[model samples]
Target: MSITDKNLGSKAIQWQAHQNSNSEVPENTMAAMNYAWNLGGIPEIDIRQTADGIIIGIHDATPKRTLSVPEADQDKLISELTFDQIQQWDAGVKFGEQFRNEKVPSLKQILAGLSEHSDRQLYLDFKQVDLEALAALIQEYGVARQIIFAHNNHENCKTVKRLVPEVRTMLWIPARFPETAVETFTHIRQTGFDSLNMVQLHLPDAEEKQSWRYKLQKTFIQEALQYLGEAGMELEVLPYKFDQEDLFELLDMGIRRYAVDEPSVFVELLNRYFN
Candidate 1:
């Protein structure tokens, strides 16, 4: 479970493509995922479950804007709709050109596709209650060791670990409030988390007219890394934007894991330095 002990360190960038839709690159679709794999970057996808227990790839709890559920019916939660009903809504039309005609995919479909390609790793973000079932599916596919489950809820992490102990888990801390970084890390550790999923903004504030905050953040990162190293856990940092300098700084600190929206760009940078 230690950073050094775990085989989770990868110089490859973890790319989270947006779920396949019209305007943005439909993330979590077979096409987008394959596109990422072909670029030699790991694919990070989001998952939610239908009321009937079928797991689907999506980021939002409601199918409102993404799927164009009518304003009157937009309040329906994913958990309240059956898989068939959920699939009836077009998850791709809203985005227009970028996604064109892609469709939302199921968890089983994504896993099967991943199984065919062995060169890439999967970063599965569980955004629903059926995570227990998803965990079972992952184990059934023998991909527990190849996928990392990211969840904001501590209990979800515990559930994944208990159901699939061999699989790695990262605690996803929301960075909406910048002041809670330290407290979040503490909670992660207390929850027996194996890794940290923090945002770039959570880094320490800089002094006026100086990059001192950057330096201070770097020092704090090293300390946290060391602490996690000693405790047999890993640290995965996700910057707010695709900044190469930030990635390089973290890499220089001996942190090899990262999540980025632009996988192609980050992977190119990583290959330049590490490959």
Candidate 2:
């Protein structure tokens, strides 16, 4: 499909801000996400639960990378601390002086801000946490329809489905799926997830990079998509960094949605290509 208005789907394929679209800053923050969204990108929060069980937008097993912390605490998981402790973290100073006052936001807080914008869409990368609390917030804000829940576990995805029946959910397709194309489709169907998110198969490794092995792998992806398309399933792929050629290959395979960290770059390419 072309990256046309039609192919891009109901809304433009906005860039999912990876970690608030800023690396040094703790992601899932209002500042970082808003910064990107204001610049015409979509916010994708990687959320996790704290030791005290509060839901917040966070990625990584520890707080070091995003939060300013001593090297000793670098490996400490967010689960080791309470929500209050997490909020006290230097969530933004490392990123820049402008964001120094920014603090980690609770899920409810983020939802509250988003409630104001009718066009705002959030793609949440769930870290297999319980969705009951999150579901309640979405309901309270009346934005259940604006969220897309993405998770790697079948049960977790099922939980999202059960808690927020109206929300769309994507199940992660493991690196090693069933042996054959038919088997892959069967596996996905069995999970009963509404959609899927998978790793992009086009990357380095010269021998298999663009040769016979690479072509064969791409063939399998195409076959799987064919079955999924016929069965009314949708696949979204995200590569850490996808070059122009990578975009064309994925497009040739009928792939549409892309969850890229640098969404503006890709979106610009898509616009240029489609126009």
Candidate 3:
């Protein structure tokens, strides 16, 4: 099916909030997701495994960027810290004082809390964890169909399918695919992921034509959409920044699944520009 057919389903486009409405405050925090949900946006969170193999909602591999940590402890990877130790560090202070009380939420906490919103679609991005363990957690919560699991490893995806075939899955493509279209498609097909996601990092103000990287990514993704669509895979893109005309261009290109940080902004933009 085409990206349009797979994602849009008669809507203009489906927008997922990056790291759960991260454009507002402390990213990957429950508050961000709550705001996103209140605004009619799909919540997205990246899960990282702690030292003891517990899953937590954290975007980066470490707490250096998102959490308040001693400079000496800045280099500690998520795998090096226990979930209790990891949660002790304040995840909200760096953003502002109002959210200073926020702590990192465990995958279990998020799943247990949000499972009631059966219609709310959640994206769970795996950083470095066993898919089987993650699958087990989802199964325990009885939310296998409500969550979309994402990872870059094709082997991991295959394992996820083997372990929990009912859970939805998405593949993450990096900035540089570094292979022929056919070769990439082969890997994607072998993985049997239901959807694909890629990040578009561009300065908000720069002209789309001024950046060679943007041009390259644009060309690559355009072809990728065609290949995946023909092979019955859907595509989703996380645009770091966008404007009304720019977004309109993307929609015209048949991109129906967008990963935008500010869902309310896009909602308003779409309502004002198209209406």
Candidate 4:
């Protein structure tokens, strides 16, 4: 299959709901995944391992931010606690009382939930977890092709690819490293990371008008795109916020895939282009 097929299903333009569509539901929770799935969009979730080696979806190092944890246990790390201990905290109360019963979902739970929809794909953000174990679990669930493993760590991308050759992997360029974005792509080409299925480019924060936030020069973007196309790798953009001008510019440049936090806003603007 082509890189696009490996990474996502057949769609003229596709988006992975960043943090599982956090704008409408709690980020990285099953509720968020279900919401995105209902909308026929892919859910991008962050994964980390518990003390007992069970992989779970969560963004931060601690549950203090997303869960309703007390001040006394604010510093507790997910890695330091067993899955059972972490499940005691309410994952949705902080987001809203209506979603109060949402528990921090384990990777198995996420996979099982996904099994129901064979057409849907998942974007798994590798935060801190065993590559082999994670790959094995995905294989066990028989949904390797339906997953796109994403990570900022190049080594982790390579490792996961080595473990599961069929599973798609995305290497996201850090927005903080705008100056070296092209250099990073050049390094990927030179080093022969052929196992890589896709590269995620971060567009500068539209609301934040800082010079450093200016992601990459246009020339650099073109060069990177040329190289990626030649290498048979797909490019997915992560614009921190939705902007009409920026989205159109990217569309003009031939970028069709995106990782968006608010799918509704992105889709509304996208519809304008087609309709």
Would you list the C-alpha lDDT of every candidate in the order shown? 0.64, 0.65, 0.70, 0.81
Ranking by lDDT: 4, 3, 2, 1
TM-scores of the candidates in the order shown: 0.79, 0.80, 0.82, 0.90
**Model 1 misplacement above 4 A:** 1-24, 68-72, 190-216, 272-275
Best by TM-score: 4
List candidate 4 segments past 4 Å from native. 1-11, 206-213
Q: Which sequence of candidate numbers ranks them by TM-score, best first? A: 4, 3, 2, 1
Residue-wise C-alpha lDDT for candidate 4, range 1-275, written one tens digit per residue: 11132222454777888984468788988888887777667898899999999999998888888888778777888899899988888988878889998999999998987777788889999888988899999998988889999987788888888898888999998766666776777788787656798998887663467533345666777777777778888888887765687777777777778888887777777776656
Superposed Cα deviation of residue 148, candidate 2 (Å): 0.8
Write model 1 residue lDDT over 144-246, tens digit each, in one string.
Answer: 7778777777667777788888777777665545446667766666755543332222342344535333423566567777777777665666664535666
Scored by lDDT, the top model is 4
Clashing pairs counted in every model: 10, 0, 0, 0
RMSD of 4: 4.0
**33-75: candidate 2 lDDT, tens digit per residue:** 7866675666778888888888888877788777877787788
Q: Which ten residues in a row have the lowest lDDT in candidate 3?
A: 197-206
